[model samples]
Target: MGNRILIVDDEWNMRNLIKIYLSREAFQLNEAKDGYEAIEMADQYAFDLVVLDVMLPDIDGWEVCSTIRKTSEIPILMLTARDDVKDRVLGLNIGADDYLIKPFAPEELVARVKALLRRRKKDNREIDKLLITFNDLSIDYDSRETWVKGTRVELTPKEFDILYTVAHNPKTVFTRDILLDKIWYSEEFRDLRAVDTHVKNLREKVRKAGLSFNPVKTVWGVGYKFNRPEDQY
Candidate 1:
């Protein structure tokens, strides 16, 4: 079966246009007209990607994206009439994978969708052989699971990817741009602050899980790295 994609937009013409283009590319498509329907449908189905519009009737796209980021890592491409930089940065920080302004070419949208799906597949392949353990931290790439102090830790998809990447490359500093390129390769307009936001969220979750030490550390005037306790000692 081809990749399943959900298109969420209040405009019938927009949905139809996206369906027409994506259907030609062999993607299985579904449509939702509102944010509420979008969230409900997402919970009920396993969609590979969501093409979401920012201005929804009920819940806005940013809220929907944030809500989804709490549980799933399904890629999201945000559509908006507003092309403001802050709006784009806000969407990215809230977990939208990619953003497209309205009045966009359908061809460009299709290309972005293809690139996101392709990057997702590549990321999966790269993590297939990974199983990293350091002190109380444990990550199993095959299962997409993480544990701290022998207790399971819940992480969003991006959180897990960032943690796993840094953990695997212990002691190696990764700049914000580097991490963005490595993880969100298809998003060319992402904010560097998004990296800091995810790291902060990841650390808070770990701390809330009763872990005393944070494995991810900041390198002064540089970026971040994962340092094993033994290595630091």
Candidate 2:
């Protein structure tokens, strides 16, 4: 079966339009008219991607996206009528993977959807096969879980991906741009600070969870790498 995608929009015409275009790609599609429905459906079903409209009659897209991020890492393509850079940045910051302004070309929409899906597949394919353990930190790629000293640490999807990517390639430096490509899969959002923010949050979480060592080490002039306790200064 093809990938299952949920299309969330309040407009009947918009939902039908997205379905029409996505149908050509042979994706299995589902629909929700408002934020509550979207959240409920997301919890009840396993979907590969979500095409979410920012404006809704109920909870709005940002809230829905934030709620979903609490539980799942499914790719989200945010649709908005506003083309402001602030809006786009807000979407990305709130965990939306991709952004598309309203009145966008049909082909662009299709392209962005395909791109996000491709990124998701590539992430799955590149996950480390073995469980990664360093010091008291343990990361299980298959289970998408992290543990510090036997206590499970709650990490957001992005935080988990960043931790896994660096930890899997121990001692290898990954520049901000590289991580952005690997995780966000888009060059449009050029704020390298986003990567820094996630790494900082990750470190704090691991520390708060009782981990004795910091696994993610920054190289000062360069990017970040996974360093064993003995290797750090």
| lDDT for position 229 in model 1 | 75
Per-residue alpha-carbon lDDT of candidate 1 for residues 58-136, written as tens digits (9 for 90 to 100): 9899999998888899999999999899999999999999999989987999999999999889876675548787777
Q: Please list the C-alpha lDDT of all candidates, in the order they appear.
A: 0.90, 0.92
lDDT of 2 by residue, 82-171 (tens): 878998898899999999988988899989999999999988766644588887888998899999989999999989999999988886
lDDT of 1: 0.90
Using lDDT as the measure, the top candidate is 2
lDDT of 2: 0.92
